[model samples]
Target: MSRKVDLVADLGEGFGPWRMGDDAQLLDILTSANIACGFHAGDPQIMDETVRACVERGVGIGAHPSFPDLQGFGRRDMGLTADEVRTDVLYQFGALHAIAAFHGVPVTHIAPHGRLGNLVAVREDYADVVASAARRLDPELIVLAQDGKLADAARAAGLRVGIVGIADRAYEDDGTLVPRSEPGAVIHDGEEIRRRTVRMVVDGVIESRNGTLIPVACDTVLVHGDTTGAVVLAQQIRVGLEEAGVEIAPLTDWLE
Candidate 1:
């Protein structure tokens, strides 16, 4: 059987007048996008344009909900209860849903952003609430997450979970991503990232910081668009995957 995976990036991450990355260029290389909702880094106009562009390109649209932390770009850990998390996520998800509906496109999935994304991997209560909110909103919605609390909670709630393998990030031997605050948490070398991506998608494994082989079952690979040379890195990854005989497709098209 041929190996198939989705290439996704965080989009619509600009608020008001500031833009973060070249979403226009990155969109050409992506099969899906996790667009930010208002709470983190998006505004009404950005969301609308992002969705319109995604619709035009036939890319899968997924909500990227974050904590109510715009100042921190959703990277700050606010001490909120699980209920707060649920409501915040609901607000963001609903906003995106309305916009997508206006464009005649249904949102195919949901992925938490930044700190919320990290917590969902280890914090079980937060993960459960996120999963429950997604279930309550749309049972058919696929939950994109790395293998952790969110994946487990989503699965238990009968939601389809698409494992996200990030090739540009470092992982521990235990199969969890290293915290971003730590040194060397993110890989910068272009050739290294390309190799890691192909290995994660085709070989089903990635090398850990400790030189251990951590097995990963990836349905989608995240390509960060905000960093330096990000578009170039994304282009290289796609070429590397195609060269390795991996079939790239949208997550909604293949994830079940």
Candidate 2:
């Protein structure tokens, strides 16, 4: 039997006049999209337009919430309390949900963005709050996260979980992603990205920055739209995965 996987990308990471990635191209390639919900990058207009594009493309819509750090692009760590985290997530999710509803689509999942996402992977408190917030808003909402505290918290909260593998980012020996400040943190070579993606799905293992193999469960693969040559890289990864006998499906269809 062929293994199934979901291809997702972060989209709608633009504000007003500035756009981050080639969203149209990425949407054409992605099965699911984690759209920025105003806190990190998107504005109301961008959110509405993005939701409409996703709906037109038959892509699954997911909330990409983050700290209220538009300046840092939500990539900077902020000291937020559990209550703050919960309410902030709730606010962002609600905005996206409303926008998606207006477009006749449902916001099916929640994936924390940037620094918040990294924190949820390791911080039990942050993970618990994010999961709890999702459950409270909609019990059926899926939580897309890496294999760690967020996944555990989502499962414990009775919400469905999707383990996401980042194709371009380098991982650490401990399974965490290497900081962008580190050299060789983000892989730019398209062939290398495609190879790493195939190995993660077929071999269930990924090579860390330190050249150590770490076990990983990949239900979905994320190709960041903002990365250089992202469109070409995504196309290559998809083709490679299919050639390797892996079935690429949408997160709603494949993620448990």
Candidate 3:
């Protein structure tokens, strides 16, 4: 039997004059792209360009929605009601959908960003709202999330779910990601990342920060595009996965 996985990266995370990562290089290396919608780090022009690039490359396009925090890049948590969160997500999705529509590309998935994403992994209400928003927008849209509340809510809401594995972030024993403030939370060693990525895809397991072996359902591996040496890291992961005999495919192909 052959093992298959999707390689994904966050793209279009740039504002008016400032850009975050080498989106062009990362796009070429990824099988799927979680494009930033307006709230977190993208504008109309950036979204349009990103969609066109994805169309040209035949890459899977996904909506990356986040809290309404541009200064903090949506990494700061806010106290908002369920309705507020739902509408915020809907707004972001609508913007991305419009841009993708203009470029004649189909948005196939939805993935939360930063603090909103972290909250969805643990908070049932947050997860429900995000899942509900995606369901309302498009029932067929796949929800890319970790193995937690968001994934469960998405599945329960009759939406397809893809379990995501963050290759550059450390995990807790309960499968949650370690807080970024903590030391060693984000893995930076290329060799270590490559080895761990291969193991996660091949064995469906990853060692937590506390040295606990946790079983994970990894449908896709995410490489942060904003990190230093992100393009090189993505290349290393792709090559390592292929070398380990794992077929790299898009999330849409693997989603149920």
User: Clashes in each model (backbone N, CA, C under 3 Å)?
Assistant: 0, 0, 0
Which runs of model 1 end up more than 4 angstroms from their true locations? none
Model 3 sits at a Cα RMSD from the real structure of 0.8
Best candidate, lDDT: 1
Can you give the TM-score per candidate against the true fold?
0.98, 0.98, 0.98
Single out the weakest 10-residue window by summed lDDT for candidate 3: 247-256
135-174 per-residue lDDT for model 2 (tens digits)? 9999999999999999999999999999999999999999
Query: What is candidate 2's local distance difference test score?
Result: 0.93
Show where candidate 2 strays beyond 4 Å: none
TM-score of 2: 0.98
How do these models rank on lDDT, best leading?
Answer: 1, 2, 3
